[model samples]
Target: MLKPFLSSSFVSGTRLIQRPLYYTKRTMSTHSHLDDDCIFCKIIRGEIPSFKLVETDKCYSFVDIEPLSEGHSLIIPKYHAEFMHQLPDDYLTDILPIAKQIAKAAKFEQYNVLQNNGRLANQAVPHVHFHVIDKPNTSTGLGLTWKPLKTDMDSIKTRYEEIKRNL
Candidate 1:
């Protein structure tokens, strides 16, 4: 079931508005087997090493080894939900608070909480994880950028109407 983003999104531009499920591609299988072979599962299970931050009942936060910037970190659910939308309801309830804690602890007043869901969207890990990157306070972090596509009004309206009808 397609649904609107739960008021957590920060994407903005003059055009090329964000669509629901735009980043999430075809949903991955909600199978227990996905857990067995998942590297994030291994990390969560203590089979692989990660610099830990916070471990709560539903998820954990840790430093990203291949960080795009300093203090870059990842927040992941304990269970192996391959996509963000595929995660259980409890995960949605649990994630934001912990992410906030991470951003605060890193001493950033502003940050980007990024979650990618498909190969095309740059979801390198099959397991669900949120990238917590602090925004520019100095020359210490990455500068996130988005160039919205320029399209004619007719084409944009046609696309909007199509998605609106579907919704």
Candidate 2:
């Protein structure tokens, strides 16, 4: 049973209608499962076509279908892991060398590495992936729009010093 919420039609004195919460719950629950039909999974299985750059027993690197830059690629574990923190250390270690190789191969002056964890972070696919984007010249493929916030320098310095002491 789901609670009925007033829709635009209902607010205008239309018929009382309700939508089931079960549908939303089912959709949410499905997100937790890595889709077997996912393009990345198919790439891992060699069922779908991809321009593979590097591959190991645990990791594979391939050019991104929708690239942020000229030579943007995705590094993913062969075994599906939804988030970065969920990845094993061995799997994590395996991808970095490949990422470095791809960056060098692209002749990039600089590169940006990015990983998004959850929906709020803009992770469209549930599968864990790291993006290595190449920056050829003075331009970095990554752009950030930030408004500088005024903070007390002494407070910032004190916080840094405290963290450094712990280190």
Candidate 3:
């Protein structure tokens, strides 16, 4: 029993009805992951038309409308989660295998499998989706500069111990 969020956004030909800020977990069934307001959920449910590439019981994939390269694509789990950490273990199984299949079919010798968890990470959509961006050449696909900061080993060791304790 979920309710729709108040606002809507239009993308391409899809009308994305948004969900509330908070979500609760529930048992899995057909449409159990259907976030009525989520655009990816809507695509999964066929409320929006997509240039579909593949669909399995647990996942669906399609070409990215705004692709970084010629064959840039996305694979999303049928079960909706705003971030990967929130996604159930069962749903995690199919994602990478399917992405691999897509990369092979596209003949992408080099590529980037990108998933962003939040707005700060540039995740425009709320649902968890994995991007298979083709890096056929340096100029075509996802281009980025990885800026790494110098860190204190003592602080890093302390943080690692703290996290290990939680694990």
Candidate 4:
């Protein structure tokens, strides 16, 4: 009876131990492909109509079809990167300056350059892209909401002072 009990416990412990899952296979399909089915790919291929703003050797900027404002545009790398983290450093560097140029061309008094990583972060498209939106005024543009938190000013000041000391 004791032997059976001990054996059961050992089996249970061994079974309870779990190995973490690692994504080893680099499936290229998980990234964007230049297919007719893909909207961004169509934009890249010039198959679908887009209001062209700027283009570089490895990137393209076009006005957003669904504009958050009058001058909303998207910046996409010619090479497919599904997520922002997956993008090569060179691709990142090349795209940002072009995005700034688009924002300037739109003549927005203020602009918001935004990107989302995953579905939970509001990434509608798997293909990596940046949204350069015109925010002309506080009113008539995109709005953001945040929950207000109540905190003691003295405590906040103390925390900032401590962080500054370490810096």
Worst 10 residues of 2 by lDDT: 19-28
**Candidate 2 deviant stretches above 4 angstroms:** 1-35, 137-140, 146-167
Question: Per-candidate TM vs. native?
Answer: 0.68, 0.64, 0.80, 0.64
lDDT per residue (tens digit) for residues 9-84 in model 2: 1122666644221111222232233458777777876778988776655666789888878889998876677888
Q: After superposition, how far is residue 98 of candidate 3 from its true place, in Å?
A: 0.7
Residue 71, candidate 1: alpha-carbon lDDT: 85
Q: Give lDDT for model 4.
A: 0.69
Where model 3 places Cα greater than 4 Å from the true spot, the runs are: 1-29
- Going through the candidates in the order shown, the clash numbers are 0, 0, 1, 0
Instruction: Give the Å error, residue 97, model 1.
Output: 0.7
- Evaluated at residue 2, the lDDT of candidate 3 is 32
lDDT string, candidate 3, 1-167, tens digits: 43323222234566654423212342236658679899999888878999887665667789999999988999888888999999988676666766787788789999999999999999999999999999988789999999987899998999999999999
Give all candidates' CA lDDT scores: 0.71, 0.69, 0.79, 0.69
RMSD of candidate 2 to the truth, in angstroms, is: 19.5
Please give me the total number of clashing residue pairs in predicted model 2: 0
Top candidate (TM-score): 3
- In model 1, the runs with Cα more than 4 Å from the true position are 1-34, 137-140, 152-167
Question: What is the per-residue lDDT of model 1 for residues 7-62, given as tens digits with 9 covering 90 to 100?
Answer: 23333575444323112232223324347678888787677899987665566678
Superposition TM-score, candidate 4 onto the true structure: 0.64
Q: RMSD of candidate 4 to the true fold?
A: 19.4
Better of 1 and 4 by TM-score: 1
Native-vs-model 3 lDDT?
0.79
